[model samples]
Target: MNKTVIIKGMSCRHCAMRVEKALNKINGVEASVDLESRTAKLNLTNSISNQQIIEVIDGVGYEVVEIIDV
Candidate 1:
């Protein structure tokens, strides 16, 4: 499944890269972040929960403000 999450605290390309790296560390995740939009789009091969994603983001010091179901 694929998902898009609106994230806060990303202010530049470097921030987006860090967020992407953090999400990619998840076993089944293929992710990318757009600095301009401050959003992270993720593709996954297995079932994953929003809480888990939130934890990952929070663990890396960013906050997830919204989970978009696209």
Candidate 2:
């Protein structure tokens, strides 16, 4: 399964990488963050909640603007 999360406050590659790393720490999740788009593409092998995703991002000092299953 895939999910696209719109994020805010990512100013550069480092910010993007931080978000990517945070997401990847979650079990069954792999993420690629696009700095230009302010989004992360998450590939999941098991069930994970959108709220969980949001919290992870938030914990890293970013905001999850929206989440969409794709």
Most accurate candidate by TM-score = 2
Against the unseen true structure, what C-alpha lDDT does each candidate score? 0.91, 0.96
**Which parts of model 2 are misplaced by more than 4 Å?**
none
lDDT of 1 at 66: 95
The local lDDT score (0 to 100) that residue 56 gets in candidate 1 is 94
Give the TM-score of each candidate: 0.94, 0.98
Q: Give the TM-score of candidate 1.
A: 0.94
Against the true structure, whose lDDT is highest? Answer: 2
Give candidates' CA RMSD values in order.
Answer: 0.7, 0.5
lDDT of 2 by residue, 6-34 (tens): 99999999999999999999999999999
lDDT tens digits, residue span 36-61, model 1:
88899999897899999999999888
User: lDDT, candidate 2, residue 49?
Assistant: 99
